[model samples]
Target: MQKFILTAMLLTALMLAGCNDNGTGPKKENQPGEILWVEVPDSIQIPPPGKFHKALVKASVQDPDGLSDVDSVYFYSRKPDGSLANKGLPL
Candidate 1:
């Protein structure tokens, strides 16, 4: 009777060990749960002659987990030389 109880307790311990949540399950990493473009302009007109121009850019962003998970949103102008004009500009 004592051996039977010991075996049952061991089995229960093993079963509970198998159900441990170690945060190593199959999870989607860096996935965008939702994407929204609030104000994506159709065209950006450059000023003629020597003049300065500024455009208004806006967006609505969210994540299923939380907003804290989002590190940053990147926005830059691609140059003709195939390089990022403004790198590490916060949005």
Candidate 2:
């Protein structure tokens, strides 16, 4: 029983020490958030020649600081050639 207790304590100490960082890495403070989810139409009817249609876009984003920390979100469309349709448009 004494040997078992000592081994367990040693294992616990090593695990804790491994989890402690010595601050050698760069800090990630104020980092930008990530887009968690996005919603867009799967298909849309084509407009007549010389006409156009607009699709609604929605996105869910998260930030380490908070939602308020996020400044803006933009969306970019890709053409059939895999090129950006235009400069990103603000959402």
Candidate 3:
């Protein structure tokens, strides 16, 4: 019907109006610096289950600015409730 067509057109217009680029969305520009870590083991086997385990992670970092921009690298682990645990470990 004409009413349904008018409603659809109004909705389409409203959607288009709401979709204006405000530049507040996710950054579209390439970052000046980036860090990429090497592929790690899928899972490490802990022998005694409750034993303390340690791992050495390696990464390759690139920066168009300079390495001085990077202060420190931190690592994090997820807890049982789905939140990050232990703040972060500085590398």
Candidate 4:
């Protein structure tokens, strides 16, 4: 049950963490970086109840300007209730 909840939260967070838009609509020259792919485990195992489980998540991004133009990539998780996690951990 815990694993399922965690998985759902992770998926939701990723969906919310989509690329940023300038708000003026799509411009070819002002296009933001594209997320090539993301990786996450199908299932995660937690040992003792209080013990924390470390899940690996990775994302590959590309920018029209260049890799240097990319500022940063962050990972944040959502709560089971579909809310942002404790102010969101920018990891």
TM-score of each: 0.41, 0.53, 0.43, 0.50
Ranked candidates, highest TM-score first? 2, 4, 3, 1
Candidate closer to the true structure by lDDT (higher is better), 2 or 4 = 2
lDDT by residue (2-45, candidate 2, tens digit) is 99999999998898789757567677668779998999986667
1-91 in candidate 1: lDDT tens per residue? 9999999999988987888565676776675746676675555677889995687878788897788888767666655677665563533
Candidates sorted by lDDT, best first: 2, 4, 1, 3
Candidate with better lDDT, 1 vs 2 = 2
Candidate 3 residue 11 Cα shift, in angstroms, is 70
Q: Once model 1 is optimally superposed onto the true structure by TM-score, how far is the C-alpha of residue 75 displaced, in angstroms?
A: 3.1
Instruction: Name the runs in model 4 displaced over 4 angstroms.
Output: 1-30, 42-51
Better of 3 and 4 by TM-score: 4
Residue 55's lDDT within candidate 2 is: 88
Over 9-42, each residue of candidate 4 has an lDDT whose tens digit, in order, gives 9998887667465365666576688988999775
Superior candidate under lDDT, 2 versus 3: 2
Best by lDDT: 2
Candidate 1 matches the true fold with a TM-score of 0.41
Best by TM-score: 2
True-vs-predicted CA distance for residue 13, candidate 2, Å: 37
